[model samples]
Target: MSQSTHLPRTSLAALTLGAIGVVYGDIGTSPLYAFREALAQSAADGISRGEILGVLSLALWALILVVTLKYVLFLSRMDNNGEGGVLSLMALASRATGARWLLVLIFGATGAALFYGDAIITPALSVLSAVEGMRTIPGLEGMGEHTILITTTLVLVGLFALQPRGTASVAGLFGPVCLVWFAALAGLGLWHISRDPGVLAAFNPAWCLDFMESHGVTGLFVLGAVFLTVTGAEALIADMGHFGRQPIQLGWLVLVWPALTLNYLGQGALALHHLAVSEAHHQLMGNEDWFFLMAPDALRAPLVVLATLATIIASQAVITGAFSLSHQAIALGLLPRMTIRQTSAAQVGQIYMPAVNWGVLAGVIALVFGFRSSSSMAAAYGIAVTGTMVVTTCLSFIIAWKYWKWEPVWAALLIAPFLCLDLFFFGANILRVTEGGWVPLLVAAMVGTVIYTWLRGRRVSLERAREQGVAMADLAAALAVRPPVIVEGTAVFLTQDPEVAPSALLHNLKHNKALHRCSILLKVETVNTPWVDPAERVKLEVLDERFTRVRLRYGYMDKVDLPSDLARHPGPQGGGLLSAKGGTSFFVGRSAIRFARKPLLPRWMTVLYMFLHRNAADPTAYFAIPPNRVVELGSQIEL
Candidate 1:
């Protein structure tokens, strides 16, 4: 398949700002509150200015190391078509790794489920944090906290309401607004840095090293503390295909990274100045107001409004990502296909899976009511982010060594440091499972189990059906003696078991058994690649003189395009197989499987089969047939 260079060639400037807004929204907004939460967690005892600045510096490097260097710089290059998500990445691995793709499927589905949890938590916290500004509003002295919460909830509902209209309708403004958002963050930070230049010293690696050494395990605990700063980078890389790799990379390199660094430095400057000016101001809260302080008092209200808008944009990006991942999960066989309705024709990137949207809505509403504050929601956020990072790092090691064919020693050297850092985050986040982190972890486990079980049962069920199927030669010979009607065109039968008899064939013979003059068995095979040439398509098989079967091979990335211009292809030898004058009727048979145990995996999994029977995508949609003509042949199966 040819790689799609069809993305809009927006200026690097526009894409960067949008990338900052869309891809990095979660982490971009995190700097607003992460430092404060870190302080609350562990600011006592002996943590010094040098150690604090060092922690900030470590966060900067982690973003650079894990996100920019590992993923955007390299992994984004491994796109399956223009698709760049965990499931797409897993599909790419399947081509190179063979059966081992199952592990990748499991890992990717788990990551995707984790992302759903992240999506839910993000909107709850981002909106709540922005709305908390009501507490600081001048002359709003008597406003209740619940009043603010209620307003925030209403704002969030409004955001979700806009989803059905599709984001692309307003995405043009996303770039410009996001550009303004990052510029504001950077300009504010830089303006403060100019007032006190010594904060620049924290950029040096040694300060971070010194802090890590001095603080020991306490400093080590801060790894999770600082990890939040880089959480959205993976999402940035995952969504790169939507915005294009070059544009996204340019945005990060020119706009996001520098802007974020400046903001951190500005915050550090506030801390340093307070330490020197007042003894009581030497603690964590000393610079707590730096973000708010950046704006003039009169403009603070407007700045809060802008921050709220940016948070909404960020939440939209995550929600869309959840929709994309859910669709891919179905395509890859990890999950059964549901009703996948495309939300926008102009942008294939914009999709709406009702199942996921409602699921996320429920989770988000639950978190908002339960946690009630951004600080608590932060506890649940990292488990999904860190868990996904670990999964990606593990997959990268294999992808790098086997597919990229990096030198073993060189690949190990390249992958190990990041792996160790990810392990550290994973270890820290594991502690959080008892905390709010359990929300996503439990969700991921439940979703993953359902997906894996259904897929396994599907394979088992197909294998058993194949074993019981009668061969086409025998079936055709048995029916050859029947008189043929002088009917018009060929009837194409679509099925997976090629020569193996479809139960529908028997049912049709019994009921609608009026034999057509000619019939063709048409089987579609989804190949591993994206497209197949016509020369390899529609292979004709003559099963004796009477019966003919045609097979069409397609790549997974390719749509099952039934040829509308069939007039172009050469017809059968004497009279064409398709009679243009006489209309052709398409008949399809669907298997109706019962989950009654036939001694498959285990008894519990047999119960899972009951669920699968209820959940499987209707054969009508799966075959890509026009529903009006397709017939559902109900069959009772034991497995």
Candidate 2:
């Protein structure tokens, strides 16, 4: 179990508002297309009051059960040092079990990989759905498909282009804008509900059952689309550290949930009213943009603009989330190091990853152009999210059993229903694999493959290194006896294993034939937690008079700065070791990795690992080391 922090009442409101903006963005925009798509799935059988109410009921219950009960009430409480996410939860479970459980790792990896798929699809679908609202505008009724596509592409490109500059300036506006958007949703829903109070019958769970029983196989198709209503539910738990559980829960229960509930009801009422009119006129009613049509014609265009802004905000939240997740993945050794830039000096979470940003942008563009319409894109949306939800449920069960110390049977009973719900959704979505659902599935497969290869390759590489390495104790003893030509300054050799002599240190001795007056073997260890206490950050072990092995422990979410952390250590002679006027130099080993004669990994896997390693960011930048004071010792290694 994770500890929760109590915030001052004054700050709670602000955090709650921020939660409304970021946590609710994706789900907030779901009303734009969720109902319409779900209703469309059954439109082939002809629109009926029963079908409308049934679909609306499915959507409402999904939010209540999946978002409110599962995420807000349950999973939010299962945080890792106040940080909640797939990776954080994985770290927590791993620690609780006192070992890295293979099943838990697979669950975490699958959830994370599927999240990237959602990340790419969200921007394209959200923006496209909102832009398609142009069709309902007064003079823009004839807006061409190409115009919508181009406009969405331009908006997406601009959003990504602005990432490097940072969102801090406009982030303050996100909460207020989303606040207005939710209020608008409530207002629109209420207005249409007043037209037909009877539509509120969708609140009855019976409608969901009746719809399922009546529609049979076709209902599952609609069920897949209905899953979109809770697409961003994961964000509630994912962003818990940013705003805390109380604020997010308050935001959901008090404002976001009511607004969404009312809006979906209003959409149902509007659809019912339209069906009545079509029947009265002896005309067939087809699937329409019920979300925008809820507005009076005069207000339609402005509503469209508000919706576009909301979708953009939702997209921004997903993009930034991807950046943050990538950072965590790298810290946890699930992925190779990549360039991470702090977009805001004040907010540590406001980060930009160039590779992630551009790569997602490219995928988003491809999805937009390839799918061509939100209706088509909606077919692809739910599988990744449902897959992630299934993984989350599985992980939560482990946390419940092990960390919470619940009886295994009780834990299973408590979690089994949610797992079934998730799997049911997953199975429903599986029926759409041929119809654009394969997109996210294909993306997840590729990403999961990379993560698996990186992990396996790292293990093999470490084994290979161990076989060729000299023990640090042996090296230290030999160095003391030989006393190589001593240099004037301190030298820090960074390595993964401090017990083994660092390759750079060996090369420096072999080629330069000299050793620094003070040689520190520095190793950074990423612990299975979100933050480490400052007192426990640095561990110093004296290997010999001239050599010391320093281990810097960091939580997976902690920011790493080698120089600053080293300076925190008071040396044996007093004064900061990094503060020495004698000056300090950092030695990093650069490896040219190739397949060994008897490779531990498959030939193809070795090649992929090598490619990933070769393209990883420079160690100097990653470790926050001063490039001018850094020396790279190159070596050829076969693994």
Q: RMSD for all candidates, in order, please.
A: 3.4, 1.4
Error of 1 at 203 (Å): 1.3
Count backbone clashes in candidate 2: 0
TM-scores for all candidates: the values are 0.89, 0.98
Candidate 1's C-alpha runs over 4 A off are 1-21, 44-48, 140-143, 276-290, 481-488, 517-586, 595-598, 601-603, 616-624
| The 10-residue segment with the lowest total lDDT in model 1 | 562-571
Residues 4-46 of candidate 1 have per-residue lDDT tens digits of 3454555554555667667777767766766655544556654
Per residue, candidate 2 scores C-alpha lDDT tens digits across 1-639 of 233457777888999999999999999999999999999999985798899999999999999999999998999999898999898888888888885589888988999999999999999999999999999999999999999999999999999999999999999999999999999999999998898999889989999999999988999999999999999999998998788889999999999999999999999999998999999998878899999999999999999999999999999999989998999999998999999998888888888899999999999999999999999999999999999999888889899999999999999999999999999999999999999999999999999999999999888877778789999999899888889999788999998888889899999999999999899999898888989988899999988778988989999888888899899879876787676567999999998888788778888898999999899999899889989999999876787
Number of the top lDDT candidate? 2
Backbone clashes under 3 angstroms, per model: 1, 0
| Top TM-score model | 2
